[model samples]
Target: MANMDISLKEMMAIDGAIGAAVVDYNSGMSLGVLGGSKDLDLQIAGAGNTEVVKAKLRTMDSLGLKDAIEDILITLSGQYHIIRPITGRGGKGLFLYLALDRGRANLAMARHHLRAIEDKLEI
Candidate 1:
């Protein structure tokens, strides 16, 4: 099985990928990270995204929706930020966050590939 570092590397190999990290949402900390440029600080982003996950989960709970999140997509003029929670065995409270250059990424395929990677990941 792939480990956290291997999973992060695989994510960076995706088309248009700028950065990726495996974060523990409970603590807003990154367990592994890859490909952050000067403009992107993955540690800060991980903390921010943790709040996003918590907020969405809180909203779902308040609304009494018994659904699990697949992914949260944030589209910008130049980038697509994807936050995917790790739901595989032993992956509780963790998530995979990927940043893609909008012009180079295929959103649907990226999501599909991410799911595949997540499945093989062993925490």
Candidate 2:
């Protein structure tokens, strides 16, 4: 099983990865962060993404959609942001956040790598 530190590193190893963090969606706080560039603030990104997660979850509930979220992707002109909520295996309210440079990133492969990282993450 991958520990938090190892998991973040594995995420960074992904092609085009710009930054990664383990966050508590409940508190909108980053538990750990790595690799953010000068233009990005991982702490703020973590907090802001918490709202994105919460809003989607709230919308799902209101719409009576019973399925759980696998991940949320936010694609921008220059970047891709992936938010994966952690559930099961004793992971309740945590999430893995990954940012990638659009020009260098292979979206499918990045998603696949992130999923693999998520699967091995040990709380």
TM-score per model over all chains: 0.98, 0.98
Per-residue C-alpha lDDT of model 2 across residues 1-123, encoded as one tens digit per residue: 989999999999999999999999999999999999889899999999999999999999999999999999999999999999987596788899999999999999999999899999998
Supply the TM-score for candidate 2: 0.98
Q: Residue-wise lDDT of candidate 1 within 1-123, one digit each (tens)?
A: 899889999999999999999999999999989998998899999999999999999999999999999999999999999999988899999999999999999999999999999999999
- The true-versus-predicted C-alpha distance at residue 14 of model 1, in Å, is 0.4
> Judged by lDDT against the true structure, how good is candidate 2?
0.94
